[model samples]
Target: MPFIPTLTLKDRLPRPFKIRWLRELMDLVDELYFEYGIVHQDIAGRNLFISDTTGSILLCDFAFSAQIGTVRHGQSVYLGEIPRCNDVKGTMFFLYYLITRDPQYSRYLLSDVDENTIMDRPKWVKHAGVELDYDVDTFYNELMAWVRKRRDSPKLAHYTLAPRHFEIPDPPEDGMEGWYLGRSHTMREMEAGRTTLSWERPPASKWDKSRKLLATGKYADERPPVRLMHVPDPKKGFPQMGMTNAALRGQDKRKQTQDVVGTEDEAEASKRRREEADE
Candidate 1:
């Protein structure tokens, strides 16, 4: 897939981001969850990118994406008996981290860090270097509002069902039961105590003077001993460079045949000359 050049949010570590960018990221995360029913379990500053051209924020790294209420590994829980880790909660923490630049709470596991704890806080204290287009409170309010709206929804929001379901097929049975060490032995051959040739690994490439020179970048200054002439193969049906359609059609049958024979002979001679030079 084609992608615009971008820098990760973490890459801008010491540099503060704008409030608008955070809001844009929030909208993108909301869309991923509510609209697409995808939970990007692994949401972090490293996964988010800022476009180099537009300076817009983009949430990425969907390797840990899962359906709303599906069960993953033991580390996380979005739904079921103990619903702990989720995108909404993750977004809240991520936004808090962006504003405050305090990674104290985020150091803990997802299930251990509670979003409500951050939400109940009186105010978010911005770091000395942290700068924003708007007041820290403004960004906080926007984030809180989104969190409230998400929390109001059903816990197990299985609204969107998969369009199609597919069962993982079993592995195909292998036909070469007696094939071992790159050698195939049929049932009859094995019963008759027949032996198969063992395959040897290819020898490592040896560095010749020319190869060493090329590897060390010394070959760039050297020119070829002989200048090569590009010989066009007529079998590929390439049009003659200077021949017009009218000129070609105007040629007599005998002359056209002679031209073809001349081209073939010249090609053969060139091949022989190349072989002799190589020898």
Candidate 2:
């Protein structure tokens, strides 16, 4: 619930306290994802907070929770097809334009949580040959190391995310490909507060040009003071402002097709996901 606009804190802190606070909050998040099998897709600035008292940081933003095994096109599929993280924009992560599979990685890589009924694991993983009592701390350390190595990485940098004490990502086998399940189709949740909620879009929803608002006969026209512009005003406000049921009904369809066609941005995200999976 803490909005970033109202607060400011040090992104760079001393290693000792930073590591302590990070690890503590990480334990809670790891448990939630692995034990409960819930994926917190929003893992960056908007969803993070530091406690003034304990100097602890916690992850928030439940907007992207989804069930295990649910599949959508081009969404990042971490291990066992569990969601990793969502692209901050249409199909990319923040800072780096990558499709991520956060839930899958958190669930399987962390200690104790397993899809294997051997505690709850997939047969494929068992076939890959893993052992019990895996120390997740090592895994976390490695990931952190990777993040450090590629400090300025945009995406695909997660591949070497850190120096792993042990490898959690299974070796990729021939003909074994992974895919992501994008947002749920026809789900009203995907449509609500879309333009407004996004932080990546400059000026955000305030910029009427960013979104081509189909004017509803019943709706009044009142543009905000200043906003980011996404689309060119060919016909300007009056003509661009019209809306119809047909225009809205096929939103999911449009999105799916867009994923298939893949703009330069989407292509970049796909490339990042592929590299992560390959590594």
Candidate 3:
């Protein structure tokens, strides 16, 4: 899918079918890594696409793809194509940051940096007491090493300098990530009545209870039926900007206000403000 899609990845992640899709997805990546010596360094949600029919999945956006060093005899040689590594910067860094939760890749710090602003986070590896080349191979190798650490860890907290255990994906099964170890999804379903959904206790009707007086010329009536409000597909018929006309209009008004108040206009407004300030 495009970097930005109408449906946010967060919305798709909860559905049972989506979970299966995710498992296949990681497997697909692993397959690509081993078979093709290709590591889809950019493994974020935006890089994924879910087919509406059959709930099929796809991995796209090869703008950052590279045929890195292969896994010989089932080894994790994450060193990507060494020759053209310098060209890659954002994609691998993103994966490393997510898998490790390293603060260097924290959204708070790395969000604003651009190609012109700064180079890759070689410092990130350096800070960790590892010497790394300034290429995609180095980036991939370093990141994989970090991932292995978390894959074998107790808690998945990223380290600043040293490698720690990481949260590893359980070995793929029939190309799926089987039931999670935790009850997070099950608990969420219970809270939302998605599991073993059954009507627990019956509610008393108005006729079953003594009628009470009301202010309007109204009489006690049965409680309204519970109507389920299904959330619309996040990407479903998304508007050009995922916005309503009223919201856009409000933004337009705000821009007008900002233009009237912002720095660039101050010079012109200064004359009028000075006239008013004097008066």
lDDT winner:
1
TM-score result, candidate 3 = 0.27
- Give the per-residue lDDT of model 3 (tens digit) for 1-279: 334343533234323222345346545754554444454555554555565544566666664554444332223555444322321333344434423345544453222444332234453333332222343344445445544543454421122112321222343335333422334545778888775644333344532345653444234574658999765333222122334465444664433344344454554554555556556
lDDT of 3: 0.43
Residues 1-279 of candidate 1 have per-residue lDDT tens digits of 447576676666525567777778778766666666666776777778777767787777665666666554333454531346677777777777877767685365667777767875564888787777788778888878877887786554552542332232332434543332322346557767887543342333642445434433344556758978776444333344444466446664444444554466665665666566556
lDDT of 2 by residue, 173-234 (tens): 44535643345534555477453332243343455664454433111354557976675333
TM-score of each: 0.51, 0.28, 0.27
Model 1, 182: alpha-carbon shift in Å? Answer: 24
Write down the lDDT of every candidate, Cα atoms only: 0.63, 0.37, 0.43
The C-alpha RMSD in Å for every predicted model, in order, reads 18.1, 28.1, 28.8
Q: Candidate 3: minimum summed lDDT over ten consecutive residues — where? A: 156-165
- 1 or 3: which has the higher lDDT? 1
lDDT of 3 at 246: 59
